[model samples]
Target: MDGEPVDARWGSARVRGRRLRTVRAHAFAAAGLLLAGCASMPDSGEIRAVQASQGVDSQVRVFGVPPADKATPAEIVDGFLEAMTSDDPQLETARKYLTPAAAKSWKPSSAVTVLSSGLSRVAVRGEKDPEGPRWKVTGKKLATVDEHSAYQPQTGAREYEEQLQLVQDEDKQWRISTPPSGLVLSESDFQRIYMPVNKYYFAGGTLVADPVYVRQRTDPDSRMDPTTQTVQSLLAGPSRWLAPVVESSFPTGTELRTGTKSLSYDGQNTLRVPLNDKVGNIAQPQCKKMATQLLYTVKDLTGSRLDQVELLRSSDDKTSSLCSVTSVSADAIANRPKIPEFQYFVDNEKRLVRMKLDVSSEDQQTRTEPVPGPLATVPVFKVSSAAVSHDERRAAVVSEDGHGLYVVSLVGGGPMPAQVPIGRGGKAETLTAPSWDASGDLWVADRDPQHPGLWRVPGGTGTPERVQVAGLDNRRIVSLKASADGARIALLLEQDANSRILYIGRVERPDAKGDVSAVSVRELRPAAPQMADVTAMSWAPRGRLLVVGREKGGVQQARYMLADGSMVAASLPGATGLSEVAVAAAEDESKPKPVVAYSEDGIVWLPPGAQWRTVAAGGRSPVYPG
Candidate 1:
């Protein structure tokens, strides 16, 4: 059964009111399974499609078949490999192909190796084994999801090889004696089995999103639905890459009520979560924060809109409600940055200009006006790149020669303040660009080779301090952008003249009583490992980045990627020849701000569901308030 031809092809079935276009092939391997476990398949036949009705929801569902009696060693190996990709709740069907002792010891959740294609199995020609047989499984690895569900993309296709040993049971039945340490799945199978969800944690006074992959349906090992699994992950604490910069509201030993396998929202769209005794004494203020985290973490799951989250204390007799928070109340506790009021850019006159966000292309000939106050009326230096404060009251601009940095108030007319002391007037690479965080601190990178480092302006007013960035060995920071939450920062590092990579780093500050001067950036993680070169990137809504770059040997294009570096979340529609891009931070996700880009044709805007249209004829840099 190593290379036997398959008998089944793509077919259709009705499951609950939706139609399923069943996938019966895995890459070049013949890995087909039936919806019902006991259904019999053809022994030998050609693969062909089975026609079915259209106009129904097209969802894919794959199931596994149990091993047959008196199966051969090769057949058992093939059956087990295919079963690993099935919809087994606990992977129990796949374990049937293993020896009783081996099944008891194997742990599938340890790690996940994602391959570009299905595994190819071949018998070992000369290996002598005490067991019945030996087989080699090999494939090209694309990525790996760690035990923490953090996804890391491999720079290139890496070879994956493992050996499987088989033995004969007491009844003379073939079974796998030694199995792989963890799961090995194809790319398509991994996407179908798991989905990315953002688990919220506290970074200072604001909530930060940490992306992790969880099973879409009931987890095979935990037997918990997606909602319950997400809550447990949140209680487990932040991922290792993000742990140093964020904190969780839940108590250290907190967990769900004993034997809580599933959670659901009531008819009023309120979810009641029962916690263990560890949280029974939690204060009202702290309990509200815990519920706020749960409300945001599980909001992406498939269900009705969640209006509120109620926490209850588990007891021997009856649980008592600890605290509750509605959507409106939770937003107040989250403390997100204020939404931007207008989009800003440097126009043809080399002066900063503003345009109302409410004006769309449909409106005839939208007018552009210079920003209020001294930066526009009084001449200082030609504006090149700029960053607006979260409150939309102050603007940070870099001179055209990239030598000077200035912070000008958008309101109250006055002379532009003197150039920031950190900027050294000499060459174009002296300063990259400026970015603001939620704490009102300004961040910029000085690319001067002799003294290159990241600089932070305290509250956009106080003395400039050089920030210590760990893990930045000999890499020059060309550009930088800070997330609105102030916990994460994205940097474009120049490894060489040809290679530029994008990385997301955590911003860490000293404890309350510790030295306040010890603030630093830590643990820079790759945000776009698959892209060979990254030219530009901006922080988008919900802790994602809109990156403009290209893969190795490919043309440049714009795509949106999760900050966790898992996978490309989306591609920018109709985006081309982009040199710079900016996205407004909106509080209401349902109505997103238009995406602005600086292209060869000048500044262009992409309204939701529409083509990119020219906004400013000679605009060079476009930015929205951070």
Candidate 2:
């Protein structure tokens, strides 16, 4: 029926010669028959009219226990329905009661289109009664759909020719429509209903997350009753929606907290305290709720759909909680958490809104054998990021899984050094660096493929456009970070053979027409002559570069240049963990000293002097807020 049949054998097997000549007359006859059949098609329009008339037929009569003349409408309807479907031993129904044809209603082939969802239409129709009286019915439906979709009335809807309907027949004493064998199975009872939709379906829909629970309604031939939708709306209706959760602090259901400490970000003051009541399926619910709101805001404010969020405790670098907007990343083949995966966040007011976790696990049983007697092994981690607002008012940390990003208050003063994604994981390909602007609108750390520029997110709530440079040598970039003044953007990119390169660039904001551009500012490389693959770098507020490397000497300060590289100055004693140290220009001019941070001997250390004074028995990355 979908198409026509072809010759069983093409080319040679097609009819020819005597066969073709003999078949022309038969084919002609068949065509004539087909044409005749078409010409003789019945008047379905008239049939439909008759069927509609039957809905209120005056000729039909019924003999039942109830007296027709005295029976009430309800009683008559009940009796007729009984007779039409009579299946008892005392009563039997026959097939003669049904009309030969029935009116068929369906969606209109040519219907109105919907330009938008907000359109509304009102209609009032009146029908004349048998006594020259008229009855009117008023109704309304979405008018916008007239332009976009095709909808229809119920299948059994009919324009009645006879005036008497839904009332008792004087003879039959019943008001029931019947099928063949007098069965009361007509389509009149099956009325169409409305579509069921909730407020979240319209307001909370995540355009990028694209959760599977959401979908468009396209039912030219709907299988469900339309009234159900109206009923649902009546029940739940609309309201101001609830805000999303952004931050949280909790322990897993498997473990309970005997001691939970509320700490701050001070390198020396932040510590863990035990809580006795924290147990299975039992977390700090208030904290978790706050975390959820913070995390969702991270998405709205930052304008990036993330994979995971985490919450970490600084005491032992444990993951206290975790969250992710999406279950996993797009390229994730199985279950692998990528690095730079967790994001740290902040709000417009410079408050820590979101946090990331920093947790790790290693098999101490096997590794212990490699060390000497009384040897012990433990895992460690660094909470990578927490997203924030443009003004840096609020901040949050994301877990390695990207599930939930927890909100933290850099100002309200809650637990300090709180992380989001708590579990341990490695680096990944997409690291959306969170940024805050003067207005509190969020921005992202994005890569630039063209001209090796920095992709800084413009302030607003919309799709992020990539900012580019005119000329440079770079490709396949993945990470980014912007300066405090919004002047510079630092980028970490993937190079040949799993290597990485860092580049700095300046930004040019949009004009009255709204456009942006980036320019390379400068480059940071090994200041040491040997320069054995520097791992990372940080810019001090005092305008100095904190570079990391595995050089032979300690306090290897030097003037770095792209053309010639760095020159080592001197070496100090007992500085073995050079690779684990991160340096920053010393603050407090009265006590100006290079802030040296490193981890060793079950303790994180941050020394104040250029000679490594070991200020904190356990601390790392002692950030001095600007």
Candidate 3:
């Protein structure tokens, strides 16, 4: 349904009243059945009658239809609004209360305003102009579902007021003529009619997907298909807020081969996708990426009904030239470069050590002694945090005093030179841990409240340049991590009252120069909004995030969250007192990888089995090469 603001006080009483009635009804039904002597021997006709009664009762729970032709203007408006909550395909019943012209033009799915229960009320002003009448709707707006169906939570008590205009038809029936383009539904109806799904996009040069909620027809035979809608929405590109940071492999102007036709499946449970000619020019690598995006998106929407996707130039094409794609883990996509197999962490002596994974062993344990880094031999300032470059040949270190950032090569046996300085020179109040993007550039936030800014330095010897980021005014960046693909950057922002918030932004770089010029930050919903502080975050496989934080009055904890802010229940429960977290994406998409976290006790690791194991007695700042 389309937009209207929600009222916090709306529908609550109604819901409670409904629940009471349901409990009473069930109690009475049970009692009646127990008292009936033939309850155990009820005839087929009797059972059918009881079932029919239940069906009617369920329909009544959703509210009955509004008055028809003889209904007043207020009645018609109320009925139309109520009808918006129905599961009728195309909202055909909701249209009955509108003029034919208005019915044909109204677009209910454009947006949705979710309101609190028991607080919505309509006020009707008499027919001032005789030719038309107007009504006002007031409520608290909890969140808004935009055209792309992304649910954005409102920051405060958002009260909304809408003016609706109505006209009379030739049959003398009152009807709404100028209804709002979007729909307004109670939170309950929204949950029943809408679902959240992720659309794949490339982040940090890797194929990752972000979740966006979309409305789906609840009817069993509606022409509107959720799978087709999802595919079309993905082709439409990422939501406006995320567009700047994520890239879509789909070519411009690409669309389903048959427009609105529902996806078809073969006997083998393979989805057949037909694409327009826009994809004809895409190179094989890009085509595969596109296929991967579609596969994940469609699989999510269809409950994994199809195991593979076959792309055709057009629906009519029967030739073998069409591309076929099988279901594979997101990690298997060829676009993302391979990460180094070794894990790195800082030891008690402030020295970097590497633990190599035994790929050939069934246990996948690190049996060899931890190798000290080449930089350990060189005299350097006390290190607080470090980031390994994407190529695994270099590392960036932040001084313990948060005054300087330095880069050191990790390869070669010769004594290493002093750490190379990068970024603005003067001492700052706080310097976040450094991060390396795909281009080998180093990024770190200078947390000087008076002049807080983000900076990018070239992989080699260029000076660090300040990068302007929108929507970061008056806030200190606590920590920053750039996605391996270089498309998105995640920042831990410290706000007033020691509140630590997480934000994701798009990174814009100059075409010729490798330095970043701007970053665009967008509001993000975290999986754990109640967390009082966010200590660490890292990108994981399948577009998930490994977030470590603590709720107010709670112990430190870590959880996985999808890009759209939904919590993933994938277990990693036993580890505790985590100070830093790291994840390594596996080469095989289907294989689960362990997540390493540095806790107060030591270096604790959570493998795929959700059990924690100690890797070292005194380690901190664990990391996997980007």
Candidate 4:
């Protein structure tokens, strides 16, 4: 798989070549080529240049003209595995190879994009050999580190045999052939290597094909196939593929659990976990996993809900369990303790390593209550809606005061969040809705005399921009907040006295096009017919939004997850807190990213941690099905 293409590339250039079976075993050969366009060439001469010198050696050259030439195929194989399972995938490795064209065509999608999966070993079949002799190389899936998608699996691997078809075009430079025929491959076969979709990254024989993962006919947990091809993910586990740390912070007394698999890390990190009952000294209330969910986080890892931990009932299952987390997880350390979150840290050996604590009041409580003090008359700004940015670097808060939005910096080590003014700037307006873009840009709905429209503020500090509305005038609507990624905005559009329509719009661009015309509804939330009206509304991670109301459906707030009109929205798995939610959003976009909330407790609430994303993303979080 590695050299076959290179040989063909050289062949296309009309270069006669002999296949060498090895590369050096010492230099730690790292091979990665993120080329996007093999189809573009101005002339034959340009193609010929590649043929002149591009060919992999079969044996370890250890010292050659190029760097990868000196590394062994084994080293290359092990290295990728090491990176995926250990040091973590660094996007820059492939970022270095993004051709100008490739970068131009790049469209950010909800799914993680892998730049390239390469191989070593330079084997080639003779002119006449059965099955064209195997082309082998090590492979690993490279992905963007999204805390929300930490639960999503890296579906690629290394150190495997592949069926390759090296296309020798007229030019002599080997070019990867065009895409394969869909109908030619069986549905079952396609899912394994080709696919009804490309989730596995197997191109299927034109370039290369291999069994990346398989359903075992016998053991459910362990597969009798190549470990490299094992889909340890769909089964359940952190991206690290072992018992991973769920989060670096957690709500106090929250339980934590691991998956049912043997976990280890980096070839050296091991866990001495107990399969019989619980792990001793490794956690609070030692010897615990027999009953409670394990809540833990190491002191060195600053993980957010994107970081995670896995549980193993036994060391044999492909996957045991996974936990959600809420601290920036690189090293275990103290996290921003504004809201309640839970985290757990464990090793590949299924042993617990560290734990962190998060805190929040009960679901029924509101305002965290005034502690019987003389400051009771002062209005307590309770959290109405909340959203954590992609990196967990900051949290967006919407409260009941005129200070429309606030950014809770997870890194700055602050007690009280720094506030941003959103209202008329002079009066005490109830600042109650906030959201964020992936880059930590702040979007808040400021409600008061003059500042009654949706506003935008970047995290680094700058002027706020007004989100334009088409049909409705500025002062007519109370508040409007954008979706988590800032692709859409949810607004409480005014109709008359008793009713208001909540609209989410596809914002063209806040800086250039003040396009207020792109509004559509994932679902239209109704205001109460009795008592009063809709005060504030928010779109949670999924298509679910919490609206403060006074009517029947308003008082006893019912949470609804609206699928992007095109699909079906799932109601949150088990949401309890309901004092008053001004806003909410999907934790992330990968696995079942939860509906995070700024609870009635004046603090925010999130899923357990790490296992936040879900495959059922609405693409436009809570965006209308346009």
Cα RMSD of predicted structure 4: 22.1
Which stretch of 10 consecutive residues in model 2 shows the poorest summed lDDT? 206-215
The all-Cα superposition gives candidate 2 an RMSD in Å to the true structure of 31.1
Model 3 TM-score (2 dp): 0.77
Which candidate has the top score in lDDT?
1
Instruction: Please provide TM-scores, in order, for all candidate models, with all chains considered together.
Output: 0.87, 0.28, 0.77, 0.32
Flag the better candidate by TM-score, 1 or 4: 1
* Candidate 2, backbone clash total: 120
Candidate 1 residues 201-266, lDDT tens each? 998789999998887778889999888988888888888777777789899999999999999999
Better of 2 and 4 by lDDT: 4
Candidate with top TM-score is: 1
Order the numbered candidates by TM-score, best leading.
1, 3, 4, 2
Whole-model alpha-carbon lDDT for candidate 3 = 0.63
- Tens-place lDDT per residue, model 2, 317-376, is 344443222223212211111122122222222222221212221221121111111111
